[model samples]
Target: MKTVLVIEDDIGIQKQLKWSLTDYELVFAQDRSSALTQLRRYEPDVVTLDLGLPPDPANASEGLACLNDILSLQPECKVIVITGNTDNEHALKAIALGAYDYYQKPVDADVLNIIIARAFKISDLEAENRALKSANVGNTDIIGNSESILKAYRTVEKIAPTEITTLLLGESGTGKEVFARAIHRQSPRVNKPFVAINCASIPENLLESELFGYEKGAFTGANKTTLGKIECANGGTLLLDEIGDMPLSLQAKMLRFLQERVIERVGGRQELEVDVRVICATHRNLAEMVAEQSFREDLYYRISEITLNIPSLRQRGHDIVIIGKALLHKFNQEFNTQVQGFTDSAMQSMLHYAWPGNIRELQNKLKSAVILADSKYITEEDLGLSARNAKVDTLRKVREVAETQAIRHAYTLATGNLSKTADSLGITRPTLYALIDKYRLHDLRNTETEN
Candidate 1:
């Protein structure tokens, strides 16, 4: 049974509510303090708050403050405000303060129960949606279907099941961390923690302590013994994001940990064993760094046992549009906008533009467009892409580009099945084969035989 917190001070009404709302498991509180106590203890999804809460039942001040406290403690809780028949002002104020709904006093048990039911239903749905979104965050967040992305996906599929220390090579904002999470989700260590630390983001002086942790009295202000990222991720995965930016002084300790699967806290001499699958990602050229003597050669070889090079957005062909559309949909839901789709000009501009920041750039542009777009479809101006900046294409060139995009999109949707791709494109197998050969799509053709 779902739980409901009833915060009313009146004895007669409280008794009436208890008798009427028999369908739910109800917890009663006569004042603000007790309501908060019950709220924390039960963590009920639905709350029916009385505007005449004790210590000042004549004025709505105490009740409103209680409502504020309840929302601050649990923002998702559905707070139904009970008000006097003439208390429209307080009711509106309650709604503005994030109360779910309001009920007028001289309560009709049936009517109040209906409102409470609706609140519970909506709360359940929001919780369910949040749960689903969280479940998909690690697995389905990497959205792409282009051959380059597919190849990366295939590589992840092969390496995710193993304990090999994987290195993800990609341009910044190419979602190296997303790929890292994907690997962790697919691996046997899926149930365990996946801790990530950015070497560049943290100061060089603190990077070692952040990775290996420090003990109490290990250094100044070290009040308590703490577990490092590696120790926290024991039996799971640790992503050393931007590993290339790690300071030379700390690289030796990292190398030792990687080779021996052991780490020593800064203040402590104990060698703690950690069995974590390490994944390193960076935009820098490690080989060049090694040659330049900035990065250790032994550390380079240890992390790069298996390397997956993530393709830049410009190189992913039609995937730019695919990723853009997915992001647009996500932003629409997030911003509560009714954006149908992108305008033709916007679509073309996204396809032709050089996305220097890759998926991160695409996500930001779409988020802004979804919020600021006035019309049913988002325009190029909304995406902040100027027409003057777009490369002009001849009529024939435009036609060829459209055809190529269609074929590739259909081919990806069909999962490289030749017959399915041909049928989806409204062309015969022979014509599809000829077009594939004409376009020199060797990757698609090579993979099609396996399908």
Candidate 2:
């Protein structure tokens, strides 16, 4: 059954509300302090507050204070305010201060019941939506249909349930962090905290304390002991973003935690054990960094128990169109625009132009286009994209470039083998040779000559 907290000071109205709101498991509080206590204790789904309480029953100040406190404690709770029939200003003030809805005094139990019912319905819908979002983390959130991206998602699906330390490797703005979250949601620790810390973003002097935490007096301003990201994520997952940029001095401490599953707080003697699954992500090549001795080889090996390489947006064919359309719809709602979709020219430019900043760049461009677009559809100019370089605009030229690109990619994968290239492209050897000749792919000829 849904819970409702009624905060009213008047005895007659409180009794009437109790009798009327029999549908809900109701809890009552007379004033601000008691209302907050009941709010924390019951954590009710809905709250009906009287905008007149003790010490200032004639005014709305005390009631408004209680409303703020209630929301601060439980932001999701729907607060409905009860105000005087003439108290239009206070009713408006209550709505502005985050009251879900308002009811004018001289209680009509039937009318108030309708409002409460609607509030509960809305709250239930929101809760269901949150659940759907959490459940769809594995499937719906990571949007891509290309072969390369499919392979990456497949890797995530396989490795997410395991306890192994997984490393996500990709270019900046690629969905490495998204995959990390997908892993966490799919894991047993979904209910536990998933703490993320970016090594590159934090100052070197503070990164250690942020990761491993510090005891009181660890530093000049340290007034109280604090739990670090790793400790906070105990029994869950901890994402070490930009792991390659982590300071060398802190790498040893991280290595110790990984090896021992334990951490020592700064200025503390006791070692605290943590059971967090470490997931590291970085755009930099850890192998090369290890070779150059800039990154610790042992730490690299420890974190890379399994490595999943997320493909760049440009590499994922047709996914650019898919993600662009999705972002367009999202931004349409966000910006309150009625933009239908991207223009044909816009789609062409998006396909042809290299998205160097990946999904982040695509999102920002779409958001700008939606906000600035005066027409029903978003144009390439609105998105700030240059004209599709002659290739994409002309169908024949596009096919030619696409065919040659496919042949080149397949040839490399097939190690310049004629039969293998033909099979990979699903073409006969003669057709492969014809296309290779048509494109003047002299690299294949050179490879054959060398062989």
Candidate 3:
């Protein structure tokens, strides 16, 4: 169970709160000193701080000081300030001092409980996101736990040790180069150079020279013989990024080099034997390009000895938040900011957004947010996401959606067997039937013969 620290000095109010909020593990502190001690002992994520305490029961001075102290020690803790009926000024002041929220006195347990629950839920999300970061600590380049990412990672592990040419297929900013480097690092030639060249970035006339190098006086600027990316890699790996953009005229030379393991430099006759492992990546469909005759089919077949498909941010599910949190921590240090986790609206926006640019776009938004956020927690505005775009649902609505999905999934998995579906859902047959009827799953009832 989650813990909550209650820092109210009034014995009656404390007792009333303890009686009413029985769902959580509650710890009480009557003053600043006791509050700090209890805070150290419990390290609770949520705290109810009364802004009128001993030594100054009539004012909020001591309580505000206590709030500052609590935040100083635990900046991530959610501190909810309780104030007098007319103490709006102090409540706002407390908020400025890093309090999570403020509540006016004449305590209504239902409202306060709702606030506390929200705090805990946010805390849980941050904790889970941080945990995901820790889980990927060993992998410096890739960060995710979703099945799609895991499947790609598994493929990398299997192919990294081999000399097979790899073709990475994914949208832009999906870390295709990262996987290329991973393959290089895991190969026997890791100690050698690992080079990458983007076919799309270089001019069509110059890409061949860039890959195979140029001899002295080969072109206007060729002052001396220079090693190209392919030769520079030598025994290591060379990643040909955006290979689909390679000029059709140059693909034959590339194919020849790949086949013969030798390259004739521009304006040179001697073929230099090269033993470099090759990896190719592209956001465009090579097969489609080949069908259009823009890309060489022979080169495509040679480069794609092994293929890995990277999942986009939308397809990775909860990995989006995990990667976002990881980026937030990274930019925090780089920009010298102490921004905490995202707000409910901000998280919902992130989840709902399509992220067409993938991790690159996420990194840009987070870097900007860290530098410009006014509050400790990042809001939806900080992320450059509009609240109007977010699909924010109530707790009841979320629960109902989850229930409906679960029931439908279980029923399909059980092949419409009523008893088996109930057993898989860990509910009684009667309850399963009632839920099916409640959700109006008439097709399932019509198909199944109540086994």
C-alpha-based local distance difference test score of model 2: 0.88
**Mind giving the per-residue lDDT tens digits that candidate 2 earns over 141-199?**
88766788878888888988899999999999998889999999888888999999999
The C-alpha stretches of model 3 lying farther than 4 A from their native spots are 1-138, 392-451
Task: List candidate 1 stretches off by more than 4 Å.
Answer: 1-139, 388-451
Q: So what's the TM-score on candidate 3?
A: 0.68
Error of 1 at 336 (Å): 1.1
TM-score comparison, 1 vs 3, better candidate: 3
lDDT of 1 by residue, 224-307 (tens): 999899999999999999999999999999999999999999998899999999999999999999999999999999999999
Report the CA-based lDDT of candidate 3 relative to the real structure: 0.89
List the candidate 2 regions with Cα displacement exceeding 4 Å: 1-138, 393-451
The candidates, ranked best first by TM-score, are 3, 2, 1
Per-residue lDDT of candidate 3, residues 58-172 (tens digit): 9999999999999999988999999999999999999999998999989999999999999998888777766765647236478888889888888888998888989999999
TM-score of each: 0.58, 0.59, 0.68
1 versus 2: better TM-score goes to: 2
RMSD of 3: 10.3
CA lDDT of each prediction against the hidden true structure = 0.89, 0.88, 0.89
